[model samples]
Target: MKLLHTSLAALALAGFAGAALAQDPTEIRIQWYSDGIEGEVMQDLLDRFEEENPDIDVVLDNVAYQVIQEQLPIQLASGRGPDIARVTNLKEQAQHWLDLRPYLSDEQVAYWEENFGNRFDWMREDGSDAIPGFLTQLTMVGGFANATLFEQAGVEMPGDGATWDEWVEAAAQVMESQGTAAAFAIDRSGHRISGPNASFGANYIAEDGSPAPIDDGTMEFVTKLVNWTNEGLQLPDVWVSAAGTTYRSGADDFINAQIPLLYSGSWQVANLSTTIGDAFDWVAIGSPCGPAGCSGLAGGAALVAIEYTEHPEEVARVMDWLASEKIVREFSERTLFLPAHAGIVEEGGLEFQSDDPNVPPALDRFVQASGETLPLADQLPAWRWANAYYGALVTRISQAMAGEITLDQARELMDQDIADVVANANQ
Candidate 1:
């Protein structure tokens, strides 16, 4: 009887151990770009995900922002891609991503479509079929103007519904009247031009999904830029400076009453606030409209799951949670980004306070502009190549502005640069 009892006890212990092993998840890996505060926020969110799903163990691999775009493809090809990754452009990674259409419920897809504009093109690559990943944020570009400078000049504030031409006239007037301050300033680098290039209706590649760089609108844009510069408007050298250099010098110029208007994205709001700290009032307005009403470039990071992952369902769950309204608000609030999710912005009730009295009107201008602008295409090759082309174009424009080249010469150079980029992207 004692031997039988011992045998039963040993068998029960073995069964319990097997059950525990079964409950443990086959490990999952996630990749993300990390910066100081955003990284910390992501880490906190990941911890929460792990806590809720005890069975799954998550391994996070943080890579530099620039490296991820080039490295992700190689890693995916090697069969060593993380179970999840934060992707920016879906068109680039569409071939590698598992089509999420099969995984998401019909109801979920409907909900996404209603709130987030159109999810069909955003989720699919090649514009046919295959949902690559979900969009978690809405990136926007607007005009950041130093309201204090305008007040000092005693210029009538720009109206919320002002057109691009009206804005240019106002800026030129300010520069002429105010000797020490520039009327308008922008980073001529690829990063800054993305928004304006889109506004100008320059498509680096053709709409038929082919590599075609020639566009008349592009030349018109160059002409407009040159004309603006010649109209007593200051085009600061700092606008064309290299990437990764802090915009602090330029922002400082604005705060110190040197530059009145700076064109940049919503992400700069926090940096501007911290750097200027209410010394003077500053406000952001939406990018002015072109022939096609206001069209601003939309860019932000997104989360994607790896094709090789054993737990695609589990990874999708985490992604869904991250894209939830609560998470969007948390991320946007912490990073000072315009919320990607539609309702969350209203729910979060984000408000900006400026020391300058003119800031309120400027904010209204931005809000109106944002409401009318359209998002840029998320196609990877086109987006990336356009950025390169725009950078070169800006440099050429800057040279023309400084009398180093004629407007015609700048246009020809830009045309050649665009042609080269489109060819390389096709190859």
Candidate 2:
């Protein structure tokens, strides 16, 4: 009877241990944000991920961009941040990212290298081979035009080789004829501004990879922009109303059909397709030109693993699934985001689902439009000080546009700002 009781107790303990093991899933928390319908689409994919791997559960924390930019660094430094985060400041935050090499199997890492080697390299430490993340959207900034507005107003839309001046003139005619509030609107973003200026040949970063915000090429865009605000061609509230790095989105203005043209990008495709369905005839066009060439800025956000996470293996599992070609293709197609996957891009090109001819064509062109802009590759993008470089350029440039400072003065201040941030970082 004593032996029987001891055996029964041992069996009960084994049962309990098995149950505990079954319950202990590796939980991955993704700090996420959205410009449009990406959040919903991502959640669906994540649910599928959890379904396949019952031992893994993903928690999506849909937070504001401010939280990621402001609070995440502190949390990462304190080892309290989420397991994964979708971030735009990859260069800035590369220091706190997990290498993801050890956790990923040899074949798996090879898959990543094949699909996203260039982008993964973007997240690595300078001169070190490391892959910390993959791109969510390989964003190439461009413009959206209200063809319906132009048609109704009897204004002819400019085709390829149209300069920024010509586009604005066309937009002004449409705005005047249709009684729209503004000729053109753009999201008040440094990235947004930088895109058009690239056509003007502005290397906001100098040849030697130092902060050099303004040159004759850049001044051409800034000068025209300044004059446009004065002439009522460009609206003030979106760009000049805000000070510093504060983003004021002009999405509403463009979507509501108030602005004749919007200087936006591919990320807006899903939103425009779903929200503005049959309401307006709009199209994406080739980016405008200046003396240099017609080109746009290419950039995007990344899904990165936090280095301090306790579950690096689980993180790798989640990343592996997310970064897979099958999953990435679905994500990009569903969300209408441009993919950075080379094979997926090369094989069939992004199988994007959209009716508007402009959307698909623009995606293809944007993907092919690499090397169209001055590559930020050499030192600016590879360095940790990129955020500071961008921040200074954006803020001071905003001030200059608002007429608070001269462009030359803004350039000087930008130089100082970059120096201060770098100096402080070194200390």
Candidate 3:
């Protein structure tokens, strides 16, 4: 009888241990890219999430934007992907990720659709049963102008609905009159050109997941760009030589009153306000358009769940929280990006600018651009290949602009390079 009692006691102890093990908190790994401030904001939000759900542990794996593109696929294949990741384009998520449709319910879908419009379709795959992730912010339209330079030249600011031709002429007049300022400046590389390219209806790819050869629109775009550079409309060495001058330099040029206009994303608003606060008044203007009216490519990032995560539900919960109004508002206020949530923009009292008086008008121009038809780039199978293409295209165009090659030669080279990429990708 004593032996029997001992055995029963041991069994009870074993059962208790098993239950304790089952109740252990789940750990979720999250990966994201940061531009300094946004990283800190995300970390703070994650800390809040951890506090609210003590049963879950969140591990952040911060990576550079370029590095994340190269590392994610290999990590996923090796069974070491994060539970949640921030992806930039839909094609990457659709090709390599698990469909998130099962995780989002019909009610949640309806809520998102009703609030954000149909823009979320960019995150969906054509035939896949998944809704990959949610967009938290948008890069709105706004160009920086050198008010000091314009004032000195006695040139009136370009109108809100100015066409590209009008803008070029105005820029020339400004440069000729001011003598100190460059006519216009831009980062003619990577997605930096997406805004102007989209405005001109020149896209790198087609909608049906196929490569679209550069059409007449592309030729017109190149011609205009080359002509602009040759006509002394661009700063010397702006596109010809590889310098350390980035889009930020272009902004600085405007602030220091060296360049009359700098085309950049709306994310620069806060940084510009802080950097050049009251030094010389600056204004934000809408980007001039092609014959197709004003338009610009949508630029931002989205949060996606990996297919191999152990805690899919927890991942979804975090995404839901990030997409929530409170967190999004906080992020927008901190980062100066336009909130992805329509409700937040309407009711959140997000004052986009306190320093520059032109910010409100510039944001309104971005809204107008958003309303126009814009083409979305087809997703590349591997992000490395996409980056390679971008780099090569930029170099080729820069060379052409410098009179090293003709536009036809550049187009032919682009076609061959694209073909090689497609072949290698298929292999």
By lDDT, the best candidate is: 2
Instruction: Say which candidate scores most in TM-score.
Output: 2
Query: Against the true structure, candidate 2 has what lDDT?
Result: 0.81
Score candidate 3 by TM-score against the native.
0.81
* Residue 421 lDDT (model 2): 83
Which 10 consecutive positions of candidate 2 have the poorest summed lDDT? 374-383
Error of 2 at 365 (Å): 4.2
lDDT of 3 by residue, 340-364 (tens): 7778766757765355665565565
lDDT, residue 260, model 3: 81
List candidate 3 stretches off by more than 4 Å. Answer: 1-25, 77-79, 104-106, 113-117, 176-181, 201-209, 236-238, 243-249, 345-349, 352-358, 374-392
State in Å the error of residue 13, model 1: 3.0
**For each predicted model, how many residue pairs clash, with residues at least 3 apart or on different chains?**
3, 0, 0
Residue pairs whose backbone atoms clash in candidate 1: 281-356, 285-366, 286-366
User: Residue 173 of model 1: what lDDT?
Assistant: 67
Q: Which stretches of model 1 miss by more than 4 angstroms?
A: 2-15, 18-27, 34-36, 59-63, 73-80, 105-117, 163-181, 189-216, 227-235, 239-258, 289-292, 308-310, 342-367, 374-405, 425-427
lDDT of 2 by residue, 1-427 (tens): 9999999999999999999887978888999989888899999999999999999999999998898888998998887899999988787678899999889889988988888887765687777678798999888777889889999999999987799999999999999999988899877776676666767877766566556645666667877887787688887878788888887877788889989898877777778777788888888875787777877777788999999898999999999999988999999988889888888878866677777665676666566555466554223345566677567766876687688998788767877888898678779
